[model samples]
Target: MSALAKQTITEQEFQGFAVTDFPASKRLKVVTLDEATIRAFNDAVSEWTVQGIEYKPFLRFEVADRLDAITNYTLGKFLNATVRDRATGAFLLNYQGSPNVEEGDARTEFEVKLSTAVSHIIGLSNHDAMYGQYYARFTVRNVDDSDSYLRKAHRRMELHNDGTYVNERTDYVLMQKLKEENMQGGDSLMLHLDDWAELDKFYKHPLAKKDIVWGAPKSKNVESKVEHPVFFEEDADGKPLMLYIDQFAEPSNKAEGKYLYEMGESLEADANFLSVPMPVGSMMVMHNHFWLHGRDKFVPHPDLCRELLRQRGHFTE
Candidate 1:
């Protein structure tokens, strides 16, 4: 439980959506859009296709504005506030009822646009080198030949922050479940820095501020190496903000290697993390620095397939 109170959002806070604490954690807000809001949003952006938004970056913001307008800007205001607040810096957005969109690639396109509106409402998404677009859409299957553990269905991807190896500042991460079939397990794991049991043990260590070399593999399409400590910087409230990933960190010496290994072990062992099961068409947006995220290993099936969309971006001042 966080030091902050579990917030209660009244209808006065917003007209089109309702905000409430996720059953498991007070640090996360679950925003459910009423069917009217969803239908209005769908109609508002029906004119803009995913390709058009991809080709015309300005159009994405326009689409965001349309949705924000339908809620009299309350939805955007609430989402922005949640992302900026240290105590509650994450939200899971889903429609209250089934979205009546067709089932197929068209549905995927609608989800892409919905996530686009969200990413822009808070901030802009960085161009994803892996997908060669603003957002990346990839599928996880029972058998994957990918270089990273991202697509592997058999192993848990360790909890860590994003943008560790990249030069960009990844302020937030937006993940939407586009589709899933014959799937089991693979719930998203989330842990806040304040909730970590051993945060102080690592933060007060001498190597907490020391630089560690970080690099991505060939599949990530990132060639250059970068350097940053695990607890890279402090938030405005003076809390630690991390930049770490188990697979990418290249510790130079024995001491650094041991530190990185122990850190991963601590995070994985920590029981405070939330195992969130994301329903289809639902999207989760979280502050990346203070919140660590990963995926649980999937139960194996011959035709298991889970499609996910990711957009990582820095906060706009």
Candidate 2:
């Protein structure tokens, strides 16, 4: 087994109802909500519909507290710690079975509520400008005419960070798979900045801290351009944190353009990226600055359809 695989959890570690790195990446913990914990959480928050939680923001935190209470406050601590720590700043959260809700739209609504609870437990999710909601739900299919790389199939979406064109401090991102049909490929791709072989190369480059302009396409609903260096800042430990993407950066000079272009090329070429197959009902949350994420291309089918829910937000601390 590879060193990474060796770090994954053994079957024995699955005993607890909380955290385990059963997945290949030690940085990505697989947090399982046992059936009891799920039941307790659902029962406690059963009074609120998804809309109710949305209307009253404080209720979201209450729901999060209830869920954590069911797990003896362990889930909240583990999730916060995992995402806050520089060494391991991501996690995959899912319950063992389908949540208690009607099939179809009702279940999807409950999923959204559950995701909201999880997000609030860690921090507040930023208002998703594209969808005009705290969270965004969109679909991908065999055919798409969107302006951005998002919602397209049959092509690999390069790894990138979120909130690049906004002024918000996007400390974390949550992506949940809602539904899928005739889907092939499209596994989520992630790479820790520390794991990238070219991390130091880019961080040490003279242009590393030079400010670059970033603007979103119309579809993103962002009206203004923002400027920040790709190597935006360092963590408490003084390691590099990145904010880069191929599509949005408007490099002005030849040197800046080439630097960004080469950086994109190097990231795509990097061998350390983890391709995680996220099942429906599973949500992947990661530290925004340290972990870059993207999607693999889908094998086109006339009926191919996939729905995804995303929430990007800042950490509480």
Candidate 3:
């Protein structure tokens, strides 16, 4: 059994879901909810609409509790433990099979509600200014005119941490695929900080903790700039943690520029990263500080399109 498998409860331990190691990386746990669990969740939350959950904040927590109740609260405990552990801070959650819900919008609503429960189980998501909600849903296509690489297609988005330009602490990030058509490639890219070969060389450098300006593009809906070093803080065990991105970083001098550039170059060249193919209903959540996430480019097809939902926030406990 892999290390993550050891950390996870055995299939017999949890009634609603089964936990295992994702094939691409043992550090990532794969949690699959059985069809019965999905059906129970859908029936439990059927009374609450997505709009109702959005309008009322407390309803979000209620949805989370309903999902946990089905599993006898084992799902929440396992998810929290996985996220809190430095060695295994990420998981890919998908259900066993289709539920009884109709396809199209009904299925999409189920996806949204499911993601909301998962997020709340871990922590509350920060309000996404771009979408004016706690979560944001965006799409990518073959051709686009976007301010940033987020919506752009045909090129690999360099690996980087999220919420680098925002003031709030981003303890975790949740990404879910809502729709896809004629999509080839575009697998989710991930790299654990501990896996980076050059982590120490950069962490011990003088510029590692020096504050640097970070500003987002107009499309991000963030106007003000924030300042923080690549290695901004340390975990409970004193291991280095990071908050950085290649695009939003604005170094003031040659020294800062070179440091930022080398960091990005080193991360991009690292061989320890994992490339994960995300299924439509599956959601991937990771520790934002320790695991860098990105997207691989899609094949150029005029009809290509993919819709994704995202939630970034700090842990309450």
**Segments in model 3 whose C-alpha atoms lie over 4 Å from true places:** 1-12
Tens-digit per-residue lDDT, 194-312, candidate 3: 99999999999999999999999998899999988889999878999999899999999999999989989999999999999988999999999889999999999999999999999
Candidate 1 vs candidate 3, lDDT winner: 3
User: For model 1, what is the error of residue 66's alpha carbon versus the real structure, in angstroms, after optimal superposition?
Assistant: 0.8
Let me know the TM-score candidate 2 reaches against the reference structure.
Answer: 0.94
- Model 1 quality (TM-score): 0.95
Clashing pairs in 1: none
- In candidate 1, position 87 carries an lDDT of 83
Where in model 2 is the C-alpha error above 4 Å?
1-16
Query: What C-alpha lDDT do the candidate models reach, one value each?
Result: 0.89, 0.87, 0.92
lDDT of 1 by residue, 1-317 (tens): 12232243233368888888999999899999998988888888888789999999999899888888989888887888788788888999998764567889777877888899889999989988899998998999999999889999999999988888899889999999999999999999999989999999999999999999999989899999999888888976788998899999998999999998999999999999999999999998999987999999999999999999999998774
Model 2, residue pairs in steric clash: none
Off by over 4 Å in 1: 1-11
TM-score per model over all chains: 0.95, 0.94, 0.96
Provide the clash count, candidate 1. Answer: 0
Among these predictions, the greatest lDDT belongs to 3
